[model samples]
Target chain A: MNLIISTLRKDDLYNKKIIENIQKNISNVEIIYTEDMNIKGCIGCNRCWLVTPGICTIKDDYEKLLIKFLQSKQVVFITDLKLGFVSYKLKNIFDRILPLLTMNLRFKNGQMRHYFRYKKHYKMGLIYKGNGNREFLEKWLERVMINLDGTSIGTYNIENEEEILNALINC
Target chain B: MHLLIVSCTPRAKEKSNTDKILDELRKGYEYNGNTTETLYLYKRNEWESIREKFYENDNILFALPLYVECIPGIMAEFLETLKPKQNCNTKIGFLLQSGFAEASQLRCCESYLETLPSLLGCEYNGTLLKGNMFAVSFLGSKMGKQMVEPFYNMGKYYAQNNYFNKEVVNDFAKPEYFSKKEIFLSNVVSPLNKLFMKVFAKKLGCKGSLNDKPYQNYIKR
Candidate 1:
């Protein structure tokens, strides 16, 4: 199974086109429109690591989504760039996933980062829609991959439905 | 020059390391006969007024901790509220501090912050990145006092020159990349530290289940 978490607005034309293409090409995929979800930003309380021990203390829609994340073989993010980075809505989702990683630090690629709690390795991709700097996004994604213990298959700038479809199919 | 310092931490002013550093910086700015104000970004109700202050100020500095290799979610949300540049001549700077001992952990977010000035139509005044900053909270202790002096000096230099001294910034962000010797030492010490932490957590009734998958039961698709 694959999970697609999108921060695009309901009426966005690009979102519509991308969703249509994914529906036609992909199977056993779950699409989450993040704006419609009841998710809260992480408060950085350290409860997930210290108190609850790999459980987010905040009760919200994120719990269900996190479970789906672990079960899925692949996860993709479709977001609009804000200041050459992920939008606040998408970043909020990313921040709330700290429980997916253990508090233990390990060295990977010559940098220290938290170890992943899950055994499965998921392929990740970013499909961004904006005129933001691509180099900055690529570097940020590279760091993200290292931390999450995921492989970055591709990062695509929205041009057309075919481009989006190809990226999804390849992933 | 009117300076607006935004301390972006989820914790309250008294408990935040970033706020403590900004406080010292504010002292330097005030010492130079400059007016300064601080806004704690977690005060969500005051965001509108803070935005107005942001527009009214000439120099804006963001002091924040690095979270998950980036700025905190609240900071990102605050950045979203800013309207695109409209004759705004604000000079923007950042003070990014992290708990990680290696300075390299904070470099990726530094690049992201550099791009923010362009998005806001402000001049980039450079960023100050510091690592192993968990000690800033113990300001009364000797180690804490030593850790904070560099920030105080950087703040004073900025107040006098209207920009961070490149030498001071570079010195403060020492060992930009950790050496092999440091890496080896960390690798040797990390496991022992983890073992100690596990024992401590167990004593706190948390047990050694720090790596437990609590959501295993919720995996039904």
Candidate 2:
């Protein structure tokens, strides 16, 4: 199975551990680091959805990442929350999903609520590495899941490499 | 009149589609007798300190590239901190360049900016939505290069003869074509990515919330 991991920041310890574990268990998995992305802000032009349909009008590395996402069996986003909110890095990428919202899908609080309903269901994961309360994460994740049409198949908390490793192996 | 144009994108200098379109507009207006100054907002952290200049200008143009469905965080922050003095009289206008073919997102921004002039009691001139300025698939594509031509021509005519002419304003506010099919595709594809991100987070042993989960680097204030 092809695995793709996209992270906005590179210096987070929890993300590093997750990447290390993926490297150990999953071989030849392709990862895209959005922190390295060079993108112009969307010009509020609806060209991607209106003209090209399913394609972004801005020429940047987003297309490359989207291509990888379409072909991969699994996709991941690594982010640090700021006071119960996604990082600016994460938020920017999330916001770019505007084009995707126009498709035939149901979203809750700006996240995909139903994911598994698609013809193919891919494994999903999240690595939260912050001091915020865990309850905040759960509530937010539930909202995202509502839109995704899937549940968290596996989960691990801050600095829990062993539990995540076990979950990955079993899944 | 001394006019100020703020370009919000980080890459306003190189291979920047927004900058190219704004540049065309600026060139078109230069011959109209107004001294225009363009500033790249990302380059200066002290954007707030320049508020005084807005007071001095008669025409103010806010040119932006959309980030997600909203303005950039920095611009939002800037707007929050901007307090126009009582009786400030700068006429406000907007010019937006987007890679998309339709101008739907501009409405959201217009809704936000509409409050700007009202709050400050300034005249709301109008907004120009330039669509299909660049193709995200090939930013430097030939069609992308030609997209800014009309903006340049119109801006020149407006600047020289009619900066606030009714015909020019109407033309600038002209709506571009849009498609429901593309919108559907985007809506569908987006959820797929969000679902993948959630599963990926679970696999990594994330601790915080799924929708707005925290990364390790966000530990500090």
Candidate 3:
């Protein structure tokens, strides 16, 4: 299974265009419109680790999303660049998925990082909708890939819709 | 110079390690006879008023703990609310702390911090990244005082020169990457560390549930 999470505003022209394109070109993929979700930022409670262990204490849409994430073989993030990084909307989702990882630390690629709670390894892809510096985005994504214990197929700007479709289909 | 310190810790002011560092910086700023005002973002009720404070101040320092290898979502949301203006005179600096022992984990987020001042047309004063900060408070005041002395010096220098001292910043972000010796040591100690954590959790009455899957029902569907 494949998952596509898009943070495009509902009224933006690119929102409909990209959704239409993805629907036409991709199959068996679950696409999530982030702007329409009732998601909250991680409050840094540490409850996911201390209180509930592998579960987030806060009850929200993220609980359902995490299950989808773990079951999927690939996950793609589609977001606007805010201050040369992922939008806070998308980042809120990213930060809230701490339950997917265990607090146990390990070394990966010469850096200390949290170990994965689940056994599955998913391929990750990114699509950005704004004019952010590519170098910053690449570095950010590289760190994200490490945390997810996943491999990056690549990151594509929204202008490259055909390439994104190809990447998604191939994944 | 009037310094505006923004504490971005989600924890309450008294319990926050980031605030403890900010307090040290405040002491240094005050000793220099400079005025400092702080806005705590954890106090969500004041965020609207705090948003206005950014435009009023010229020297701004953002102190935050690294969350998931990046700035916390609240800080990102706060940044998103600021309107971009040309020729803005605000000079921005950042203090980033993390639980991880290696300073390299904070490097990726530092890139974002470097770009932030440019996005707002503010001059970049540089960022101070510190790791292994989670242990500072637990180590008690004697050790805590020693650890935060550099931040005090940083604040003192910034108050006098309008920029963080390059040497101090470099020292604060030392051992950017851990050595192979350190890695081997960490590997050897990891199991023991896990066991100790389990014991600690058990003391808190949460031992067996550390790996509880509360959402397992959802996955089964």
Candidate 4:
């Protein structure tokens, strides 16, 4: 299943439209709006690694999202821009996703990386808005996916429906 | 320079690698008669005050661990709250450290940070990139302190000059990426390293396998 997560608040008209448009155009995707959720950022506590084991210690709506991601083969993030990167809410989501990975390290394609806890590959794509660096976002997504033993589906702009289609098909 | 050092690690000051490095940095920075103050961005309730500090300070340095290949999410949240400084002559810099040993892991983030200060209407004070920072957690106390003690000299250099010294930064960024030969060597030693990590995790009270998945049912894709 493909998961399209919008990190923007649901009330922002432009953000809501962007998400609704994706829902209308795309097939077989589940959308998540994080702004209305009671999610907190990961505090770098290694409890998931040493204590809970694949379960984040923090109790929040993100636990459900992590389950969705574990079941998702393709995950595309929709982020409104902030400092040329994804919004804080989206970045917070990314940080909390760490529990799906093991604290143990292994070498893959020469560099060291954390082993995937669930042993599932997750191809990642990005849809970004505002005055952001699209190239940098793509590179960031590509690097992060590679670390998870997955390939990049690349990035797209809201208006670039053609690129988004290509990326989703490719993902 | 009356520097305002912002520690961006989500961990508390006592347990942080950022704290260890910054302590060494402060010792050297203050040695040269430069005064400094600190603020923790993890305290969300104080973000309003933190924003105030950002505006009031002449020189600001962000010391952070390379969490998930970039700045921590909370720090990203704080940075989003900041508006451009307009005419304020605040010079901003980054001190980025990571648990990963390779410098290549940090380059992508470094590239992003190069353009960050200019976007906020501030002068770039250059980034101090370091890796192999898992020591603070995995190593003994003395060994961990020894590993970060080099930041003292780096702090002294930054205090004397306005930006990071290229030599220390380059030394910290050794083996930016591995060559074919280095890869072959690293592959041979990979098993030993893995065993060491397992033992270290065990010592830190990891109850089960490091690869244990309590939520294995979530993988039914």
Candidate with maximal lDDT: 4
Q: Give the interface-residue alpha carbon RMSD of model 2.
A: 15.3
> Across the candidates, what are chain A's individual TM-scores?
0.92, 0.70, 0.92, 0.91
Q: How close is chain B to the truth by TM-score, in each candidate?
A: 0.85, 0.68, 0.87, 0.90
Clashing pairs in 1: none
lDDT of 2 by residue, B1-221 (tens): 56687776645455567777776788778856767888776665657545656666667787776554435544543444556556766777777655444554355544545555665557776666655554432345566557676777767765654345545544564543334554567676876855664554455454433423112222221
TM-score result, candidate 1? 0.92
lDDT of candidate 2 over A97-142, digit per residue (tens): 5444332234333332222212323345665566444544454444
TM-scores for all candidates?
0.92, 0.47, 0.93, 0.93
The clash count of every prediction, one per candidate, is 0, 52, 0, 0
Provide the lDDT at A28 for model 4. 85
User: What are the per-residue Cα lDDT tens digits for candidate 4 across B4-85?
Assistant: 9999888887778888889898898999688999899867688899899988887999988887767889888889889999
Who is ahead in lDDT, 2 or 4?
A: 4
Whichever of 1 and 4 has more DockQ, that candidate is 4
Q: What residue runs in model 4 are displaced by over 4 Å at the alpha carbon?
A: B165-168, B179-186
Q: Write the per-residue lDDT of candidate 1 for residues A38-112, one digit (tens) a residue.
A: 888888766688667888988988887788887887888889988778888888888887898887886766777
**lDDT of prediction 3:** 0.80
DockQ of 2: 0.03
What fnat does each of the candidate structures reach?
A: 0.53, 0.03, 0.57, 0.72
User: Where in model 1 is the C-alpha error above 4 Å?
Assistant: B135-146, B165-167, B199-208, B216-221
